[model samples]
Target: MKLRDELNNREGYQEIIEFYTSSINEYEQEIELLLEYEKKGIQKYSNPNLEIIKSTKEELRNAYYKILKSMYSKGDTIEGILAIYLKLISYFTETWKKSNGYVQMLEMLSIGIMLKIGDKDFKLLIEAVKKDDPQDLLIDTLISYRDENWKQLSGKLMWNKPYKALQEVIFLAKEDKNLSLERLHKYLKKEWFRGAVEIQTHKSKFNIHSGYWSFESGALVKILELDDATLKDQQYYPYDMVHYKE
Candidate 1:
């Protein structure tokens, strides 16, 4: 594995890695403490605050996701990245009961497909998503992966710019490979990072920066078997994961 040029030799890479590592450890310890409180039937004032446990788990998974990205930026092996991803998926499966948000669900499913996770893990991903409304085109697209059916629902997309742009890529993927590739290219170049506050500025105040990647774009390429020859070098497109075998 090679370090992503964007992150290679960049200042604060080690600090970012250390920050994520420490955050992951802190979240783990917090989960343990919460579990102990639950076991002992402790309460904060009158409320048991069990919801905090679930929220803490969400934070833990997020930390894992960041570490996975940091590992990639730091030139970690594929196996190492996959290991962290598996932990993320497992934790998500165990804790996540409903759709966190549209973007979050999309990113999770996309990364799962891009990684070519095992059938069991993939099914868990599907099950987690089954909690969302069936009318959602994103949910429909995600379910299509398991059913091996592609649904054309471009007419049903909402007017939200970023969401619509991403949904277009997935829908076009099944109809026209070339157009899908073009839309993906356009999304990566313009729409993808429109509201991404995390990486908007060149420098980070807390060393939380990690490589930017469009796992969903890679997932579309993997699911539809679209040739990404032209997209391989596009900024934010995770080309290596798209072509990763075994």
Candidate 2:
């Protein structure tokens, strides 16, 4: 659909615009407050116990989560919520550059996790990450351990795994100019992937290896110019370290 047609066809279009406008304004205002706090020498992790920092982070998190949940509960379509998510990501990217890299890394990863519950969300995130932190390299290197094996996250590739996988791909790309999807998957198998399956029942519909995982894995494949067949094949293994030979 044309942009105008999409806007015109969406129900409560004006309301959606108003919500985004208001939310953006509020988010900007909050960022300003955080900046002012920083100016006052209020470091996010100044305290020995980091109580103040933790509290502030929790508050920031709850507020964002509340808004996201509220939007989802109101039957806002994925596109609508995605609009807000991108805006938030934009703001967070700026905030990330200003704050300590590690703190913002964790924050962005958490937000990424929440937003990556669906295929659309994960797809959106890949675009945003490229724009905000190209190649997912910044956060990846900052939080990722270079020597860690992929199998460590075999069955538990949660919040940071996708980025880690992408980072691994970067290394793989350099090491093997002839890198292929099968080769990449072989590399992945050597590290952290234990595999399992979850039926798409309503209660477990959003579990890992669901739509988002496949979408994310696909994104990584595309970014790395690798085939996606191996990733698709790995989704069904109910055991760890599949076809291993030691």
Candidate 3:
């Protein structure tokens, strides 16, 4: 089948195409205004020490949301919404890579896309991002989403099977003061699909002590290093464990 025919055969695909085609001028206008604000920020804050003003950041965010809502209201699927968001991010980031507020704008826009897409659509969203983004935006966005979800989980880990065994380790740490990296590796190998490699790599990528995952809530929690000499210190010395709310 032809590509156009293939796309048209998908439910809601033609509507999404029509929506973007009709709204191209509007999208361009918003993007142009947003880029103007970004350029102004770059000129205003020549010194690397200085940050973009809050108002300028808010303007960029508003422009992004305006376009986002437009596409969302057109009744596209979550995958379609993600495609729209990625295109916008790609366009804006390429246009203003050095703009003081560019990364901040992308961060805000990406998170909003995830939340709007919701946890139930995470797999579809990630796949769309992986397919479209070449600059590792999906990796950054997923880490951010997972971190936010962790905070919402409080000390309780997600109850899904992938995390269930890890939760047992968390429970043990709560009961016994701390958990060593070795012990975490053991449970991760047993339970997590990607096992220890996935989390250890994430630890470095996110600049955290160790581990990152998300849950139903919208906040992120970080695992921190803990050591109590009285309890007994392993070779790793301090253990990595879930941070308590207190």
Candidate 4:
């Protein structure tokens, strides 16, 4: 069960890891709920707390569809609507910095859709993300909207699950703050989270700051910086290149 012992064997490494990491209570509870539903028995979007998240996902999908509708209001065209979705995905990714959870969810959603809906829709999104500027639209109205939402989500409760291997941000997301940051940070530092972290940056920097939405002040928000500097730190990313803005 020691880390070295497990990784030493190549035959059943994955199976061993899954067995040790999986929890009993959570797994059983989720499985029971699925059986009760008498459905496909897939355990997703089933977390009790995720009900609101599911609703939020619906809202975003509706927003994307509406954008498509407006663009094609004059006359419905398949290509035009596809163009709108491609732009929407880029805009969505450019803004909406909430819990790192959003990024994982969006990637999963994009992948799932591409598999189900076919490669045609997938191509549009791929084009948008690959090409920085929209060849189709001169103006990006979503730019402002993405910024506004980013500001709002910044203030909400968030998680700080970083990648130890990559040393980059991973599952940064929000859930009700049942535990204090200190408690959560301690929990993360424990050996269990080391594996949870895929990688850390060359900077070897890791920290979490607690901030909230400041509607009235409209100023910079500050919070406790809970990270330590390490010699192994990676390079810092410039704002313009990362922010998806000119």
lDDT of 2 by residue, 80-160 (tens): 655566545533443343223433343344344433434444344344444544233433432232213211223222345
What lDDT would each prediction earn against the true structure? 0.70, 0.40, 0.37, 0.30
Question: Over the full model, what C-alpha lDDT does candidate 3 score relative to the true structure?
Answer: 0.37
Q: Show the lowest summed lDDT stretch of 10 residues, model 1.
A: 150-159
Best by TM-score: 1
Q: Which stretches of candidate 4 lie over 4 Å from their true place?
A: 1-13, 20-26, 30-98, 117-246
- Superposed Cα deviation of residue 35, candidate 4 (Å): 11
After best superposition, candidate 4 residue 80: deviation in angstroms?
Answer: 34
Candidate 1 residue pairs in clash (backbone atoms < 3 Å): none
Task: Give the alpha carbon lDDT tens digit for every residue of 1-246 in model 3.
Answer: 122112123334344345445556564555556567676754434533123333433344344433443344333344554555554553443333222433233333344433454443444433333344423322333344434642222333223344444445444555553454344544433444343123453224322222122211111112223243332222211111111122
How does model 1 fare in lDDT?
A: 0.70
What candidate 3 gets wrong by more than 4 Å, as runs, is 1-23, 26-65, 72-76, 97-246
Candidate 4 residue 149 C-alpha distance from true site, Å: 21
What are the candidates' C-alpha RMSDs?
Answer: 3.3, 13.2, 18.7, 18.9
- Report the alpha-carbon TM-score of model 4 versus the true structure: 0.19
Quick one: RMSD of model 4? Answer: 18.9
